[model samples]
Target: MVQPLDSRQRNRYSRQLMIDSIADSDQRSLLSSRVLVAGAGGLGSSVIQYLAAAGVGTVGIVDDGRVKRSNLQRQVVHTVDDIGEPKVESAARFIDALNPDVTVETHATRITPDTVASLLRRYDVVVDGLDNFATRFLVNDAARLAAVPFVHGAVYELEGQLTVFRPGGPCYRCLLPAAPDEETVPSDEPMGIFPSVPGTIGTLQATEVLKCLLDLGEPLDDELLRYDAADATVVRTPLEPNPDCPLCGSDEIDDMDDIDYDDRYRIED
Candidate 1:
């Protein structure tokens, strides 16, 4: 049964309550949802901020790294005071400060195959703020097999992309079937961030998550939303599930066991 919202919630979410689609009942649903953000860097920073602000009942943050002075450029959730703290801990603190009604579970560990599915098992939605394609594929496979929704976002110099993947919808694998060589894939951390790149992508990702929770707007499940920060243009392209996709079709991957995401990071054939 959904819990009734108290006066405090009403006051906290007053502005959002004004939206016709997110009136009393929808606010209650948002208050009862659980979301998992897989990284605590640039993308994770903004994703965590908006989800907590929107009053998600439970927010799980998973990151194995500590904050550094350099991370402040785009990691909006962490401040200079938290420079040496672990990202999950810092993000938790930020959420607590913004909305005490939110319950944050901090996992100061990496997203390895052994822990991915188990960690993701309880959340209603998994937001992929991860930097590498290797781990993103692992998350995509786990969410697909578990029949959970995965919202994916990534930012390069001045470009980024966002998409949603669920049971019947196209997945990351449907878009990029095989992991590229380490040398060929771009690194998650850039020499210098444009600042707004992550900010833009993360906010759009949060919007998608909220839409999924409330079932209000159309999701980007069968399309890729790409942003070009320099020119401020967004292009939406249609996508379809690949019948031969190794992770979601005839040759579907059902679990993380058969894949090796370690140094080589390849799907086992």
Candidate 2:
């Protein structure tokens, strides 16, 4: 049962509460939902910030790295004081400072195949802030199999893209069936980052998550949103599922158990 909002909640969320679309009941739902952000880097900085500010009741953050002086350029959630601290721990501190009502579960570990599904299953929505292609595919495939909603966002310098993959809908695989050959894929870290790019994409990702939680609008399940920061232009293109998509195609990939994501995946013939 949904609980009544206390006076403190009313005061804390006064502005959003006044929003006709997100009134009292919606605020209560936000305070009761759970979201999992898969990385704690540039994109995560913004995703985590907005989710906490909006009062998501439980948030699980997973990152196996530590903060470094080099990361401050775009990782706004960490400070120089947290340089050596684990990313998840620093993210938890940031969330706690912004909203004590939030419960943070920190996993200072990588997202390997063995643990990805179990981690993602714990939340209502999964926000993709990962930096590499392999892990992104791992998440897409896993979320599709688990029937969970995955909000994907990626920023490379001044360009980025955003899309949503909900249960029974087209997934990331439907857009890109296979990772480029090892030698052709981009490096783990982009050549350069126009800091604001991540903030833009990540904020949009948070918006999609909220929409999914509230069921307030149409999802981007069949479309892809792309952004170009240099000229500040955005293009929303229609995305059609590939009839031969490896994950949800004529030849479906229902199990991810033996898929070697590190080697960029393969569907045995």
Best by lDDT: 1
Top TM-score prediction, candidate number:
1
Cα TM-score per model: 0.95, 0.94
Candidate 1 clashing pairs, residues 3+ apart or interchain: none
Error of 1 at 1 (Å): 5.0
lDDT for each residue of candidate 2 in 1-269, tens digit (9 for 90 to 100) = 77899999999999988878887889889989999999999999999999999999999998999999988999999999999999999999999999998999998988877788888876888999898877888888788787789999998889999999887668887877767776686556346888789999999999999899888778777789999988989999888777777677655455677454545544444
Off by over 4 Å in 2: 186-190, 250-252, 258-262, 266-269
Could you give candidate 1's per-residue lDDT for residues 1-269 as a string of tens digits?
77788999999999999888788999888888999999999999999999999998899999999999988989999999999999999999999889998999998887877888898988999999888888888788889888899999988888999988877989898998887876776655455568889988999999999999999789888999999988999999998999887777765455677555555455666
The runs of at least 3 residues in candidate 1 whose Cα sits more than 4 Å from the true structure, single-residue gaps closed, are: 186-192, 258-262
| Candidate 2's TM-score | 0.94
lDDT of each: 0.87, 0.86
**CA RMSD, predictions in order:** 1.7, 1.7
